[model samples]
Target: MSQDGAEFSFKKIAIPAFGPSILFGLGEGAILPVIALSARGLGASVAIAALVVTLIGIGSLLSNIPASILTDKYGERWSIVGAAGLSMVAMILCAVAPNLWVYGLGVLLIGAASAVFNLARQKYLTEAVPIQYRARALSTLGGVMRIGVFIGPFIGALAINFFQLAGAYWVGVVAVVIAGLVALSMPDLVHEGGAQSATGAPTVRSILVDRRRIFLTIGIGVLLVGAVRASRQAVLPLWAEGLGLDASTTSLIYGLSGAVDMLVFYPAGKVMDRRGRAWVAVPSMLLMGISLLLMPLTTGALGLLLVALLIGFGNGIGSGVVMTLGADYSPARGRAQFLGIWRFLADLGSFSGPALLSGLTAVISLAFGVAATGLIGLAAGAVLWYWIPRSPKTPS
Candidate 1:
């Protein structure tokens, strides 16, 4: 295949590349809205329940390095299968747990499995897709997951009507099992480059050392991008609540925003592939930043919705950018390891964004905190503009 992904038909690999991700996203979405509630049902206080929700991110953060190693050693297919199995077990445990501790464990396991599953699939696509089509393939992957997540809550609601809160976990169980089966059925593609290590496979530590420059530079922009993206979830709801909007109204606004978000992924990818990463990346950050900066000023649903839509559009267009950039910079020798670190940095920013907001809100005001986060978005756009390569690098 040519470097441009010539003669590649996305439809040919659609099932293997995107099917499992949809299932996984469905399972994850089904469970996310209910985790804190589940913990509360098991006797956790509000604070403790909230803490339990954070455990998922904590688990993912802790597991990234290990997940990378697993992917490197076992390859993407088995790792995905294994992760899916783990997810099923976690969901079942959550469904049947006697107390909050056990349920927390289940949630943590779910996160760990997610890390592995996501990393494996990303590495798989990075290897299998041609360079020219890479952005489109990855953006589609991101988009499909968003689609599944968008549809998942309705499925969970239907399940809940019949079986109550536990039904959501059951939905997760079913989703992951199907995902695992899909993964098992996928045909393995040949990776283009052989391992680079002379003595043996490079350790994650060694890969980190070798790729420190990329991590320190473009990686910082990725971190800020992640921070802004993740913060949007918290910012919108909090602002809505502050404006006296009810839960249902907030949810409707959120859903509308997500609808906008899902619409642009494919076009975004096409632009990146044809033009450059910066064309999409810089604009995405700027739009999100500008939307966030305007969010604090909204006092009505219409204003909030407009700003939220803009944020969604910005985020939507940036789909798969981080993964595409990671794949571009990845060394074929230690590709999984490199992406592992990349994901870790991004995840760290995700965690930090909320924390930063909370701290700033406590010290000043909610408006100030949110606007500060917007500034971070603008800063990220600047960094990406300066740092992102004009052309995608073919993995060495």
Candidate 2:
């Protein structure tokens, strides 16, 4: 089979690039638990601790458009490599920060760099993967990312235990640098030369007008999914603590669930391609609602772990399946913009999930709030499934 009519092996280019990006994604995922713990150790308030999540979101939101512009100007590979290089710098800044504010600034930079690298690579999705199997390729991308995130935090927990936050930052920096080197080894995307052919490229003016509408539609979807998943992961430890679970227990739960996601991620992507993106999303949505709402009912560790695994499984669909579908639906001219907007909206949910959980914890209880997110996710998924229906990423 061929992608973009170029006879190629999926295992080769996609795997190499996809693998490094996974580390990048993992670093992004691991930051929260370690950093929040760092803040608490330094005597920061819970509100201040929440700032790290906000900074990351602000960084992602602020960077999206600029990152797109950079990708269009410099090409995807160089832009992604540059992003990785910047992330390395961010990790250094984070490692030595004396306070949460400085740490927030460093994380902000990390978010910006991540936004660029993520967009450049995702834009490459439509152009690089065969239309017939784009969902699968997108899923593969998600699977690798899940693996990195799965490893990063568990390793990070070790660093934090032995050496403190500095250790986690050091590891993150090294991993990011390696990711950059890996990205550097990849070829430039095919669109690097004359991607906007004169015949059909959207005029710059028209692009500005229409891209927002598409962004509007997809942004809502991203917000729904990003927030639901982020909140669950971000505050799950807090919930565990409330339930009397120990730190090691929390890590074990997170790790075990991550394993489930890792296992489900690739197969889920393959299913999306074979069965269609909608198939991956619809039932997953139903399950997400059922699983999360049941959080209040779990009687013990086994029940909590099962809920965690269910969340991962649903995410295996939404994060992996639906996100790939978004890559397909986005127009090529402003594909980066679509992604930027989509991710930026998603970041809103990502930021809010933790913050909201913290706030709600004050009023009601963490478990109740957590369950609410599942309801929101179900609502969002239903709207998207009904509205989008069955179709290609672009026109069929």
Candidate 3:
């Protein structure tokens, strides 16, 4: 309310939180690519490896609503700390697991923990950050995440060389422990108004019943976008390997793409805030679609590298766009619940995408998987083009 309080800088307030955020990203990045690879190495087929990778999304989908409920009940601090701790435990399990089934369970736990951690963090940011700066703040958060992810795989590559693929899980364990420690020691920033309804406490059923139109329309588009994005992560290493690229080169190329994505993070947010979210969302989808199409055409490392760069550029331009939009549409009352449903749809899409791709690859060919994602991306762009402009500016 006072002039001095208004001048309190986000940079100072967010530093402690940033540490955990980046570390979490690093841990996920280091371990996730290797999950599928590890599964394949453990005698699973390519399709089975993809199923293992999809478990993360499936776990997140299962946990989203529960995560929101926990955050609303307990607040961000405990939710994050507990989730980080669970992530560390899951990493340890993955490291020592004797079979693909056990490793998949660990990965599933990581995903569930991730859902809780991410929802809590997003809730905190939505409540604490000023509206004028919201997009940029979220985008910068995405950038911080991108930075760790970009750096993680390179280190993971080294770890794999020295200690084998499971070594990546060790790196993840360290990163998760560091993140949990940082988060535990940090001060909790309390916001003025908690996300509760004016009439009474809101239930997920009520929110869905009330916002069904927006949920079905723009939500579908969001789902498709999330699907394409998740497919990119799940398919890339497998695709590269299928094309005969070595592990180190694949990691390097993927890391470089992440670098490109990080570069545009802030700018993407700026564009969204200034020109409306559509400006970024539509273009990103189009670019991503083009990249997916080109992916199947890649014959070697260089060609894969080119597609990776395009996917990075596409992904970069939409940094934080999903969260920004989620915040924009969420009712201040019951924010977490709304986000829970929002993210559930997205996570469902993410799970189904890779599963669908794996099925398509098994039935037809990898090229069909690529073509399907390309088609989905293009369709998603069209949905955004039509839906975003007509949506109400304020939460109902």
Best by lDDT: 1
* Best-performing candidate as measured by TM-score: 1
The estimated TM-scores of all candidates read 0.97, 0.88, 0.87
lDDT of 2: 0.72
Extract clashing residue pairs from model 3: none
For every candidate structure, what is the RMSD over all alpha carbons to the true structure, in angstroms?
Answer: 1.4, 3.1, 3.3
lDDT of 3 at 239: 89
Task: Write one digit per residue (lDDT tens) for candidate 1, span 109-203.
Answer: 99999999989999888878888888988899999999988888889989999998999999999999999999997767666555445557877
Q: For model 3, state the Cα shift of residue 312 in Å.
A: 1.1
Q: By summed lDDT, which 10 consecutive residues of candidate 3 come out lowest?
A: 1-10
User: What are the per-residue Cα lDDT tens digits for candidate 3 across 136-251?
Assistant: 77888778887887667767878989999878988888887888777775556664355445557878898899889888999999999988998898678988989888889998
Q: Which ten residues in a row have the lowest lDDT in candidate 2?
A: 387-396
CA displacement after TM-score superposition, residue 303 of candidate 3 (Å) = 4.5
Ranking by TM-score: 1, 2, 3
Candidate 1 wrong stretches, greater than 4 Å: 1-4, 192-198
Error of 2 at 93 (Å): 1.2
List the lowest-lDDT window of 10 residues for candidate 1: 1-10
What TM-score should be assigned to candidate 3? 0.87
Candidate 1 TM-score, C-alpha based = 0.97
Report the lDDT tens digits of candidate 2 across residue range 197-265.
Answer: 656554434655776665566557667766677777765576677788988898899777777767776
